[model samples]
Target: MTYVPDPARYDGRMPYRRSGRSGLLLPAISLGMWHNFGGNKPYENSKAMIHKAFDLGITHFDLANNYGPPPGSAEETFGRVLADGLRTHRDELIVSTKAGWQMWDGPYGDLGSRKYLIASLDQSLKRMGLDYVDVFYSHRPDPDTPLEETMGALDAIVRQGKALYVGISSYSAEQTREAARILKQLGTPCLIHQPSYSMFDRWIERPAQAGAPVLTEVLGEEGIGSIAFCPLAQGLLTSRYLDGIPADSRAAAIDNPFLTADKVEVRLAQVRALNGIAAARGQSLAQMALAWALQTVTSVIIGASRVEQIVENVGAVERLEFSADELAKIEAVLKG
Candidate 1:
């Protein structure tokens, strides 16, 4: 049976923050339906995960038109859940979807072209059974397409009331600054930038003397929101890699080109050290990684394969803030 949220259901632990300079705000621990809500997954389990997230006060749900292994199946499945379970709370939800990579086989299936962006958004809306998305993002920068054209399409999407706000993902500091400028000029300032960040990954701390400030600083200065994905370094921050890689873990399940068995061994050392730090603070490694992200960025977008994982993730927000010494030690562990 499908489950609907209780009218009095609420969890006060998770926090919310404004999206950059925009009036829209998102939950501190937003959930991403990128991995587990796919075609081959169980419908009941996906529904339970979504319900559990809502119960934990995760009001934001991030999705994409091409998330499933077969592509577009995730949105379709989420549509089923929305239609059956969460439709009553639609107004209380912040739903977002993006389109950039590739989804189908055709000239109009990928990239940041105006045609592709608009078409993908339409398909995404249809699959989610929604009239408008809270946030529609250009999934990635289209180096081949002019930034103006791409941002123009995003602005148009907002103007048409198809998306309340626009965002960009996987963009560098330079690209994020340029996109923010174009969007601001168009009167629809880019709302947020989603990048991959974690304790094991510190790309955001690049030397500012070499170029402009890091993207996180740029977004904070430009008044654009910053939400990090893969905050657990694709589950490396969790205890799953502490002993060894389980067959069900993301690195073992998918053919990750970046995270090999050897890299897991290297990251295991980091995880062990970081785990010591988390234990010192009386938090799990997962909580420490998540709290580290929330302490660093405006929001941290997390993905979960089960309801229990979502429950554990929200606990990070209870003690989201950390101390100077903790941050210093985290930096040291990251450097090692």
Candidate 2:
């Protein structure tokens, strides 16, 4: 059977926000390919999720060179989906991919060196079966490499028509400021910054300068948009752990190093407290967590393994507004 997308995919079902001071607009909730689209997962399931996301007005799909369990497989999977289902509507999508982590073995295969970034993006484009991505990101800052060199490579990629825009991820405020300045000088302003932000991870809210604002505020000042990852804190903010970690959950998976039992235990109390406030707001814990993150950033990247999860997560956009007392209660819980 042939797959045709819903005719009304963009019929005001989702909201879009300007990416920083740029003309580009991203969905309030973008789909991330950080997990669940790899070779280890079912292709048909991944395809279904992608189609559902698009049908729901999730125009942006985020990817990275090192996203898969066997790195690079997610792009390969997404490439097949693009060619099979999304080829005709490419213009309506904002596809993004990143480079800058350890992608391959050799000396030139990692970091922010010009050689690595260029080669990595070339591979990423090939894997995704696209001539150009809407946005290409330096996955992280390379302390060993000059910021000018990395930003210059990004500018060059845009000039070569391989990427329409350039961005950075996991970079500190100072590094972001410097990179944005360099990109601006080269006539290619930084489009967005991908940072790990959530109620559980509030590093972005911490003051980066003695008397200045936080990193998110700094990005606003630099005219760079922010898309927060881990907005659910790896399921901690959701009801997934309310009754204790399930054997099938990420925290209970032995291979998952990012989320462990000890960490969940440490934050369980806070999570429960926030859940109470979420109940008062007439939203689920996951929804409130996403709404909280989007309250500050331009958008939030959500990873879903199933179509139902995507449906539930996108509903967060409906209840984004919070009362002053609700906000105060959330702060009190976090500060506890």
Candidate 3:
């Protein structure tokens, strides 16, 4: 069967925002191929989610060199989807991938060194079956590698036509400034930043200054757009654990250390308190969290497990604005 996308995809169903001072206006919500698009996961489900996301006007699909359980499987999954239906609409999509974490075993396979960054991207392009990605990111700052060497690799990736633009992920405010300066000298200005942000995690919202050098402040001065990952705090901000954790929930998965059952119990009170506010706003806790996240980030990457989840999450765009009273109340709960 031929997959036909919704013609009304761009019909005001979604909103776009400028990424800092860049010309790119990304969907307020993008899709991240982090957990569910792995080789061990069902192929049909991953393909369905990607199609549904595109039909909802989400042009950006985020990936990384080491996204799958076995590593490199997510890119392969995405490449299969592209060939299945999205190949013709390539120009309408913004596919991005990253490196800088432990990808392969051995000395030259990880970190932000020139060898790792370049090799990782080249391997990523091959896995995704692409000549170039719309955006390429250094997954994290390399403390062991020279800042110039890492940023220079990014600059070279752009000049060599392997990436249309460059970005950084999980970099601190101070690190961002230094990298931006190096990239500027290399004639490739930083385009965006990918960070973890949610109501439970507000590190990026700190006051920006030379002494502190908060991320939000540095990005403003550097003219870089930001996309937040884990905006739902690994499902902590959602109603998933309101009544208690499900048997199959991420928190219950023993292999996933990012979230734990004990941690969920600790935050259950705060989650319920926040859920009440979402109810008053006539939205689900997940939707409200997505809207609130857009308050700081140019875009929030929605990590979904199924097509129904994508459908529900995209509705957050319909009620993105929150009144002053609402903001204050939400703050009170978060602080409490």
Candidate 4:
């Protein structure tokens, strides 16, 4: 069947939020293709998810070059979907890709060096068959490279019109401030900061190695948007593993250190406690978790293994406005 844009796509139900001080507005629920959109998986499923996202008004689609079982496969698969399925809707999509972690077998394959960042974006563009990305990120902080060299490359990319805005992920507060300073001086001001934030992982609020809060108050102070990934804590917040690991779940399949069998039990208990509070407030545990993030950050970069998950997540937008009593109850349960 030929891809047809939704006839009522702009009927205006999905909510949009401003990203910090930037002029751009993003859909409250942005989709991230971190896992699952791989070559091994059926492309039609991923295609359907993207279409469903747009149908529901999810304009932003987040990606990384290395996001797949074999690495780079997600981008390649997404590229085909973009070409064959999303071609006509390109103008309606806010696509982004990042480079920082290892993608190939050499020194230049990683880090925030000028050569690596530029070359990686070029390769990512080729893989996705796009001339440019809406946003390009440094992925993570490079301990060795000078921040100037890194953000400088990002500034050049923006100047060259390869990326509309640039951001960083997993950066310490001091690093975030320094990078923002340089990027601002260079005329870009660090459009956004992507961190892994959820109910369980609160390190983003803690002090950095230099004794300064890693996120501090600078994100809000600088008016730089914060897009939190793993908002469901790698599915810990979801009820999928409340009983035990399902054979098809990420924890059951990848054996990623962050989500293990032991964590499943521990997180299940926490999820159950949180679920009680969510039930009191007339929301699902997943919905409450996502609402909490949206209440705190500029955007929640959520991932979904199924179309149902995305639908469930989008429903959370309606659940975003929680009362003070509801927030207090959630805090009490989390503390317990």
The sequence of per-residue lDDT tens digits that candidate 3 reaches over residues 1-336 is 678999999999899899888788899999998999999999999999999999999999999999986699999999999888788899999999999888888999988999989999999998888999999999999888889999999999999999999999999888999989999888999999999999988889884554787899899999999999999989888878999999999999998899999889989999999999999999999999999999889999999898988898899999999999999999998888
Q: Write the per-residue lDDT of candidate 2 for residues 26-62, one digit (tens) a residue.
A: 9999999999999899999999999999989999999
Query: On a 0 to 1 TM-score scale, where does candidate 1 land against the true structure?
Result: 0.95
What are the per-model C-alpha RMSD values against the true structure? 1.6, 1.1, 1.2, 1.6
Q: Higher lDDT: candidate 3 or 4?
A: 3
Q: List the residue pairs that clash in candidate 4.
A: 173-214
- Flag regions of model 3 displaced more than 4 Å: 207-210
TM-score (all chains, Cα) for each model: 0.95, 0.98, 0.98, 0.95
| Ranking, lDDT, top scorer first | 3, 2, 1, 4
Using lDDT as the measure, the top candidate is 3
- Kindly report which residue stretches of model 2 are placed more than 4 angstroms away from their true locations once superposed: 208-213
Give the per-residue Cα lDDT of candidate 1 at 292.
89
Q: Tell me the tens digit of each residue's lDDT in model 1 across 147-175.
A: 99999999999999999999999888889
Tens digit per residue, CA lDDT, model 4, 266-293: 6676688888888887878888899998
lDDT of each: 0.87, 0.92, 0.93, 0.86
After superposition, which runs of candidate 4 have C-alpha atoms over 4 Å from their true positions? 209-211, 214-216
